[model samples]
Target: MPALQTINVSKSYGNFKALDKVSIEVGKQSIFGLLGPNGAGKTTLLRIINMISVMDEGKVLLNGKPVKQSDIRNIGYLPEERGLYKKMKVGEQAIYLARLKGLGKQEAIKGLKEWFEKFDITSWWNKKVEELSKGMQQKIQFIATVLHQPDLLIFDEPFSGFDPINVNLLKDEILKLREKGATIIFSTHNMASVEELCDHIALIDNSKTILSGEINEVKQRFKDNVFEVSYRSLSPLSLPAGHFEQVETQQQNGVFVSKIRLLNGNKPNDLLQQL
Candidate 1:
């Protein structure tokens, strides 16, 4: 069964339609990427799933059942906009958020301690949120989000403030979460991250899902029959006419590199046979 499903969900604000029959299914224990341009209703859809906003039409299902208020306990959400209280100490704030998700005081503390140590932020426990850099604060927020070990995690622009090393750390943790049997809905504008982390993807444009599928299948669907061949050859390379159109050719380190487009439904093997 799917971990979560939004069935033709729609949301509107006055004359503005933020989501128009937006629908997506997230597989269990997998990372799903929610991608779109600014103002494309990606956040609106996530809000509906989190019950922060109501949908005008359609329903949300978790584990093949209709979502209930109690189902919120099964989800951990990190919004695009940070929500840490600047005046509150990092550990104090994280524990409070964990409590809100139904973790007891002791359990919350224990969990937060482990996460903080993992992120190398144990020293920031007593420090006020305002004292940390944006990247540091982001780490604290991430720790709080996963402290309860919810079955489903929703992260919107989770890597926004991190440097390269921190970004990779977050990526590793996200993959680890999936391995630990958590389903993740990862929303970001970064296509590179999507390529690296997502098992499935849905692209929303203008409040509608314009594309969606398993990552590799989606990539194959949009392929343009372009191929690049690199080989070592002493003589100038030649190809059969009509099998391919050579777009470019170059020689580097005594190797010929060529980019070609298949013609008339010809396969790469056909081109190779000619060469």
Candidate 2:
């Protein structure tokens, strides 16, 4: 059974309909991406799943059973907006959040120490949250989110404040979580990260799921049959107009690279023969 499933989830706030019949299935221990442009209701769908907001029409299931309030214990959510108390010490706040997620005092402390040490932020323990940079605070938020070790995790724009090095660090950790049998719902606008981390994805636009599937299948479905060719040509290149349409051409390092799209049922072999 899928670790989580949302069926025809719809939600509205006043006159604005935030979601419309959005449905998705996340396999067990898989990294599922919730993708969409801003105002596309991706966050709304996530909120519904996390039970921070209720859906007007739809069902949320965990392991094929209807979700309940108690099931909140099974999820860890890191919102796009950071919410640490600015005046609270980093370690204290993290412990509080972890305890809220059902971790015991000692467990939270041990987990926080391990995570802080791993992230190289052990010295920031007693510092107020406001003393840290955005990226530093982001790391703290991430540790608190996962310290409870919930089976399912929802991270909204988890890489927002990190530098490239930290980005890869967190990416590696996320992959490690999946390897350890946790299902993750990752929401982000970074297509590169989606390609690297997500096993399946759903694209929401204007309050509806416009596309969804395994990543490679979605790529194949939208492929335009364009091919890039790189050759060392002595004379000006020529192609039969009916067989191929040249989209772009550029010279790099003594090689001519051109992007060509097959036309009128012509194949690459047909283009090769013409060349």
Top model by TM-score, which number? 2
lDDT values for all models: 0.90, 0.90
| TM-score, per-candidate, Cα-based | 0.89, 0.92
TM-score, model 2 to reference: 0.92
Q: Lowest lDDT 10-mer window, candidate 1?
A: 235-244
lDDT of 1: 0.90
Q: Where does model 1 exceed 4 Å of error?
A: 228-241, 246-259, 272-275
Clashes of 2: 0
